[model samples]
Target: GDDVRVAAFGPNYANEKFTPRCTAVSMGSSNNVQRELCRAKVLLVPTKAEGGPLVAAYAWALGVPVMMHNTGIAASCQECYARLTGDAAADAATALSIVRGADTDPRWQRP
Candidate 1:
């Protein structure tokens, strides 16, 4: 992640701030989160709600493990977690742990 690598701030249409990496993008859309989820080995959702979220479904279908620590997740979420934390450092550590843990997991194995 290099602290920051070719990042486009979340979809902010009110200000229209989407600066590409000096490259010509086709749609000019800043849906980096989705793209990252698709390419990442695991999906880290910080939200507090995602039982059967379409995003989670997408990850499940794409064979990408999803890690989260919040309430309201459905009982079917074996890939989800509920770690407690309020520090950014802890969040990063937890997220990293989830990412690393998922690397060796066979739960995401495709059919």
Candidate 2:
């Protein structure tokens, strides 16, 4: 199997037990949130709720693809990404499958 590491930064991660493959860190201050997010190869947004287009737009602007639930907002972004069903488990599974072969979408390409 390919090596995979999971790291989460947030209060939700505190006191959570994870497999050896996963790690959690504090979310820290808001100032550095973007910087921290950029470190990731892909941004995972697992919420069923929609936070408007900017949420996914910002990630794409940072050159990070987002795997998020299909809440209309993500699809509206007009970017290529794996759109997830509302089911948490299913979404996560689909995201993993997509990311394995994911690449920067051509829409994000610059001349």
| After superposition, candidate 1 runs with Cα above 4 Å error | 1-36, 70-73, 80-87
Each model's C-alpha lDDT? 0.54, 0.62
What would the per-residue lDDT of candidate 2 be over residues 1-40, giving only the tens digit for each residue?
Answer: 5455566644565553654546645555555767765766
Taking every candidate in turn, the Cα RMSD to the unseen true structure, in Å, is 5.5, 3.6
lDDT of 1 by residue, 37-65 (tens): 56666555555654555566666676776
Residue 89 C-alpha lDDT in model 1: 85
Question: Which 10-residue span in candidate 1 carries the lowest summed lDDT?
Answer: 2-11
> What is the lDDT, from 0 to 100, of the residue 5 in candidate 1?
25
Q: Give TM per candidate.
A: 0.52, 0.63
Clashes of 1: 0
